[model samples]
Target: MPPGRTVRFSLSLCLLLFSALTGAFAAPVGQAEFERGVAASQRGEHQQAIQAYLQAQRAGFDQPALQYNLGVSYFRLGDYAKAAQQFAQLTRDPQWAALAHYNLGLVARRLDQPDRAADHFEQAYRRSDNARLRALAASALDRLPGTRADAGTTLSATVAAGYDSNVALAPDAETVNLSDNSDLFIEAGAVVNHRLSADSTRARYLFGGLHLRQYLDVSEFDQQSLRLGFNQEQILQRWQLDLRAYLDNIHVDSDRFEQSLNIAANARRTLGGGRDLRLHYQAGLIDGGARYAYLDGWEQRLGIDSLLPTGAGWLRFGYQLELNDRDDLEQNGEFFSYSPTRHSLFARLTLPDAGHWRYTLRGEYRYSDYDDPYRISNGTGTTEVPREDHRYLVGIRAQQRLADRTALFVDYRYIDNDSNITAYDYARHQVMGGIEARY
Candidate 1:
């Protein structure tokens, strides 16, 4: 038999062996727990699924498939530590090994261990045809520090500012329809990282603005946000792991507090040079009225992304399917249930030539529907209605690098979107030119 076919046969036999070794015999609860877990997962109840599957595992359901499912549950529930622990059991079995390694990298990223995360993404990317996962991993390549910072611990602070033309995101009008007023936002933060060892195991924790946008005109439209989070990293040759947590708040246009506290862990593996694949599962609770505006109901996301090698550049792909279901927009109520689904896809290409002018081509699409919002807001008219929106965007960028930390650039972008919610359909055109200087 051919080697590729041989590996497939070996994988199949391994699965058969795993089943026999763990089953000894199937327990009574095996079917019941599996069924319940499946139902919960379908309903987007990850935590409940985790508990149900754990019960099944305790009842002697030891298949690698079951174990992989259990790991998925923990990941969706934002228990990265537990999820990683569960996935560790399946790495020995080729059937799910690649996917498990992919998921491990995502949890590592959530935990803020970049090097380890990158390694895992690389491994998974090489092992699977999931091109999307590979691209997601490659995107992180640019986010990591360069060779200069590779030598020792360093303090890095980042400040980014951009202006978005439409601040209120009102219904049915292009940015051209809205008054010339644009949304202004500024974000700045500092990070302290310490290299734990030679393999570049670094610890990173950041405290900064999640996003801050102030309407140049109205005080009611001003926004101030604060976010605090920490992550620990353990970098490995083929795998990476991270543990993380975050707390955030947003006071937008003087609206009530939009508070969020989330905890998650993710890991990634590298399968090829400059290629990666990853999986991510995160769970979070929103305590505020904003859920009434967006999906507004309690929300959660479970998704995967990959980066793969192409001729000259890499292809990027990601899928984030999220569900929001809450009974009351007031965050306290007995009636009303609104569940909306969101799925996002991303694509981008980076130019290969190392020149003074760097360029990237990128696009993104997002869809969101809110069924009820009242369950999250105070008693009065808080239920968020269900709506679906589709967006398509493409942009090109040009840059001129100059000496003395001075650079010039120009950007042109076009965005088109359509939504059932009267407030969402519109087109945006932007052209900008500027010079940036640093001391």
Candidate 2:
């Protein structure tokens, strides 16, 4: 009785009628061509069905059933022009007009003529006598061009406050006196996206964001960043492609610390049933300043990921291969290269809203192998050996919706790093709560 259930049932009935209608058609006592055409159509030999149907027409069979099957066969064979003509002819028959219009709507959509498709679907919805046909038509009209995929401008803002178990800088193997301090921090960010151009098959956009983070007791560790980017996306049949380029500037203690240019290409394909598979590649050229200059170089990543509908939400999992080629630098008269090849596996699960609340859980594991040996000094001598690291990260976030465009969230993260180098071993915990608003 519910609208959703009614529509689903109608859809199933529609498909069954379309595919099995052959059994309902009666040929004249001597006219076997129509029967042959029906048998061919049921066997999925659409081309052969078309020939047999033409032969039946030549034999004086002018039934609506014959015309409808012809239209379906043409549409399935990608001959939209002929299919449209056939459906147009059937629209003159009172009993078959509604279904004819519905089929015409499908053909129009395949041709990318959304306005025409909407018109046909509306006609089918308004004129049909059968409840099932009317329901199917209404559902089609509701899913017309005015969808969430329409391009437009959007802006959002976020503010959060959190505590970090360790605000200390990341350590090098030789930096034995690294601080392991804790601090309270506040974060604020705003992002905007403006559509540059859009059509049914593609879109271009410009995007930018600014973020700032400050520590209550460690003023010198404050961070800020600005990012600007361009993105283009296109759909070709079943595949969606994306290209992006961005520039990023980062500051520490109000002094410029890093600048980077990043470019990426991505492709995604639907696997049906609310599932998708994606492949992506990204490259970044980074330049570091002052005490962080040794980090200057390039990094690249290749990854594949998939999303599967789980109940009402989704589960995403992926693997990435990373190459970080940083400069070799001398510190205290010892040379070291920070280059590393890394393999990472990650997964995330998002839960559908329960009342006003939603949740997500994510985790990652990474293994890193250094390209060159790291130098270390002992009481009696110095030695060099490649450093290896295994890192684990897990996080959870919960959000409560306050309105259509606003939500409050709490996030928690834990990270543990195990490395052959003693100074690199550490564990950290961070927790944050935030309000986000979008328009």
Candidate 3:
């Protein structure tokens, strides 16, 4: 053979052999890259994992597991749009469809698209054969704004049995004729929200609730309340705003107790860094029942609150101011007034979820100064003095998930009311445990 031909043949043969070797090792290299990506992801190094995953993809490694991991890495990196895109592509596979839809729901929720989130959750719930996944999807659906009860409706129901330390809310030093000062009670409540219309920026709903409490030993203290309302929510500029109007009626011992018409408006603003601020105003016109006509009043309240995210949970704190104007009447030549200006401070802390368990702690303090004097019986004589009240409350609740939309909860509350008038001072403790279901 000629020298030139021999040299060219040898070089070409070597290049062909090298190419064959590279092709033979490509899959292994891709798999190694995928493994590295998974390891980085497990270490919470999402950015590093993303680079390895992209390298694997470039090496022609196309796998469902790889795809899922890549999507999750993107999600962890706060690139929700890219994560959503990756997940959306996997929905074509039967095995991955449920999971992909579930992740898409999470992305939509993070983006504040409730309707889209609900749709995705519902799809996941329907398509999933795995019980745990279905339950998770249902729980996600329950958390959405207007899709709980049924499509376009929100519903929740709870039943509890508890003991009240002071059924009459009477002071310890009072000498009133009462059959029972403490009682065992059972309570049930249901709330419903039905969506009327919705768009990207605004939504409307019809909302209502029913609550009933029965005392085992103190029948006269049994109470029932029914409320019906309408709510409108909208986003304007950087604020989300809500307007609500409702009519509420209360019954005690099977007789009418009080009735009120209420209106409220609230606005929420995101302050970045996982914090939010809310401002609200509420007004009501109250009418007392026949036996308690003197309690008729007009009430107004203004409040501001903030929500702060913690590494392990969240903190919510608020302040409220209340103005009350009630009837000033003279009965049997005795004067009475129920008006007061009240201030309230409240706080709540919600702990991080531990598996399917959740917990919260809350406290509140209130101060009230009466606008008019009350005729009090001191010793053997009646004296008129303006009433001042200080109220304190602390509570805790723990909940355990039982299913997709059901949970068992235990709650405890303590209240202490100190008032200048002895008749209104009281200390009370309540413990309740119950089941709650949402749809």
By TM-score, the best candidate is 3
Separate clash counts for every candidate:
69, 0, 2
Instruction: Estimate the lDDT of model 3.
Output: 0.79
What would the per-residue lDDT of candidate 2 be over residues 184-254, giving only the tens digit for each residue?
99999999888898776688989999999999987787999999999999877767799999999999997
Q: What is the lDDT of candidate 1?
A: 0.59
* Model 1 agreement with the true structure over 1-439: per-residue lDDT tens digits: 1223322332243345445554464455576886687568657687887788788878877666667666766766678888887666555444455566666766666676555555565555555544554444344433433311243444434444556555555543353355544555554444444444433355554433344554445445677777767666665555666767777777766675667777676667765544566767666677776434432436677777776655645566788888776544332442333466778888777553344566777888887665543233445755554566788889877766654234566776778778764545766665556565332
Cα miss at 310, model 2 (Å)? 3.7
Q: Estimate each model's TM-score.
A: 0.52, 0.66, 0.70
Q: Is candidate 2 or candidate 3 better by TM-score?
A: 3
Of candidate 3, the 10-residue stretch with the lowest lDDT total is 1-10
lDDT of each: 0.59, 0.77, 0.79
Stretches of candidate 3 off by over 4 Å are: 1-150, 378-381
As a TM-score, model 1 comes out at: 0.52
TM-score of 3: 0.70
Error of 2 at 283 (Å): 0.4
lDDT of 3 by residue, 155-265 (tens): 889999999999888974245567568889999999988999876578899999999999998889899999999999998987789999999999999888789999999
- Candidate 1 residues lying further than 4 Å off, grouped into runs, are 1-163, 172-211, 254-257, 289-297, 326-339, 371-386, 397-413, 429-439
RMSD of 1: 19.7
